[model samples]
Target: MRAGTSPNSSSCSAWRSEAGPGVRCSCPRPRGGSANSISTTDVPVLPNAGDYTIGVSIGTPPQPLLLNLDTGSDLVWTQCQPCLSCFNQRFPLYDPSQSSTYSPLACSSKLCRALPLSACHAQCLYLYGYGDNSIAIGTLASEAFTFGSSNNVTVPNLGFGCGFLNGGLFNNESGIAGFGRGSLSLISQLGVGKFSYCFISYDDDDSKSSTLMLGSAADLNGSATAVRSTPFVLNPSQPTFYYLSLDGITVGTTRLPIPKSAFVLQRNGTGGVIIDSGTAITQLTTVAYKLVRSAFLSQVKPPVANATAEVFDLCFSLPSSPSAKVDVPKLIFHFEGADMDLPHENYMYQDSTVGLMCLAMFDSGDESSTIGNFQQQNMHVVYDLDNQKLSFAPARCDQL
Candidate 1:
């Protein structure tokens, strides 16, 4: 999911500031070429199911954080000391006082240049917004980072945010472990080289869980489908964005018949189908949005009127008739290289009122769309940078 100040808030402009002298921006700018072009790499054709999760550590004891495997962000941050208003979770807090290696970034430091602040004062603070309307703000600093299941490897001098206070869903989260491509992010710092993959599971309920693979590939159950990888545009001035050549979308067996021009690439550099674990719902463009929602409602028997929520564009009554079977066609997400099909559970939800409802499942706040946790459930998603491709495999998250 994308993070910044509120859409209407003037304070949100902090994301565009320029770095001062000698300080370098972590995001890589486009090198003057066609935007959608993929770099030269060996596109490994592997069977779906070899999905794995990347292990992210938060706090001093380094509690293992299971993230949704996102490619849209770069800075990996977590909750820390003085978390007076935080939510319930198993992770520990990072106490800045305890680590002798902890060093706050100077206002004039290159890292602070791109952030929105009145001045390059070392006292500036950074904050992030969540879907649940939670906010986390803190000073930026360099600390130690360790990855892997054995927890044997460690990377020192890692730049991360140490949030002292956070609001909303963030209170429940340790902090965000960003997986965007940049020098400040885990993938960039570990020298693991470019390319990592993520495997997400599809679950209708809490049973869903997924994996993120760093500098390696996870073991898929051998039923994975490979999709073409679109080049990532790293906007040096703002957050990173993942760009995929989305040809079209299909509901079950029927194609929505929407034009390809509807889904345009974002120009701000940070544009594309942003994959995020922290967000519970998925956001889509207006055209793709209408088609997906219409197809979902058509499948459910006894048509229900759309309900209004602050975020979601459409919601339907749970399918009632026991004889009424919701035949969700394999929702096909057509990228340039391969077409990926999502199972029924990805869009259908059993609600408290409506027994089963076809959820539009996403929101586009302004205009951009996001692929959040709800869509990632019950599927193994692989982000292979080495081969410049993305892969997917279905999983039994009901067992999670």
Candidate 2:
């Protein structure tokens, strides 16, 4: 979910750059020690579900919640008690009154001023709308947030939203644990040097798990997995996002002729490529995406089908026989310093409704493009904020 919800439903696009968190381009370095490492409860790809969820214990007595790991947006919040318009969640709503340490932030507080659209009554209140028009309106407050199940790490005065009027892309997961480059994001608050996560491909399997490591424990040098690193480019206007430099893309071995300027970040901070965890599929600028599509259509023999699938633009019919197979071309994403050669499974997904093989990427229609989670399967991505670089290693992540 690049990931409070689906790829089509994102809060990042809805975010106004002027209202974003004041973040430094230099980045924050981590203090020593394992801040926390959470073993997530996986709810793999289901009929209409395929987003990552991590557990957190919020408030005094510790109301356990499963939150989406969203690096795309800022603000870590959960649905609180007396939810005036809450969505259906699996766990009980958090009651701030029951917690001994819960307190609402004052309207005059610095935290309240960090947001773009905020109104202060007696308490700091906010109304966040996503690009898909999803809304979460609630009061801003500080509470104790326990990080892990085993080696528990508690941050006693964490700033978060107490969502009372939440709607849109939100599903069963309580709320978003924001890891964006914003002052109010959990990553910014914890002052962690880095964070790392490896996602297994989404499937129907229920018992699978993955680990999210924060602070000093997020070191990539300690892992046996071979890795590559790419420098992180900044979007000053939209400091909440982690931007990347994409050189071009390769279909099989042939690198598509895409100008580097096509992926460049405008000085005003508008157009660029960002590797998002919340988006289910990758989205490339329309022009660049068309080139890739054209190359595939030219090489592949199967005729394109206008499949019943709603989201995907490229879907093709397979041979009638069960044993028949088609050679789906592999896609290699050329980042500034590293190349990610994804397997066939990573780029192509089967639409069970129509039995059509569909391309897992999208055409953004504008300059902004996103590298979604579908292509990141089995890749252990490390957001090394301390060094201002993104690194990855192909690993068997399901064991995490």
Candidate 1 ranges with C-alpha deviation above 4 Å? 1-70, 83-89, 114-124, 128-134, 148-151, 194-210, 218-239, 266-272, 305-324, 352-354, 363-365, 395-400
TM per prediction = 0.70, 0.86
Candidate 1 C-alpha RMSD relative to the actual structure = 12.3
Per-residue alpha-carbon lDDT of model 1 for 1-400, expressed as tens digits?
1121112211112111211111111222112211111122111111112112233443343333333234556665666666655555333455566555677777666555644432334464676554456566778777655443221344566777777676664322345666665555555555443443333333222223322344443334443243334444334445554555677888767888777766555565433565655455677877778777777667645456466532345555544566655554577777766666766666655554545354737647444566665666656555655654555566552321
Q: lDDT for each of the candidates?
A: 0.50, 0.73
Question: Which residue pairs clash within candidate 2?
Answer: 1-277, 1-278, 1-279, 2-277, 2-278, 2-279, 3-70, 30-193
Model 1's alpha-carbon lDDT is: 0.50
lDDT of 1 at 87: 51
Worst 10 residues of 2 by lDDT: 16-25
Error of 1 at 380 (Å): 2.3
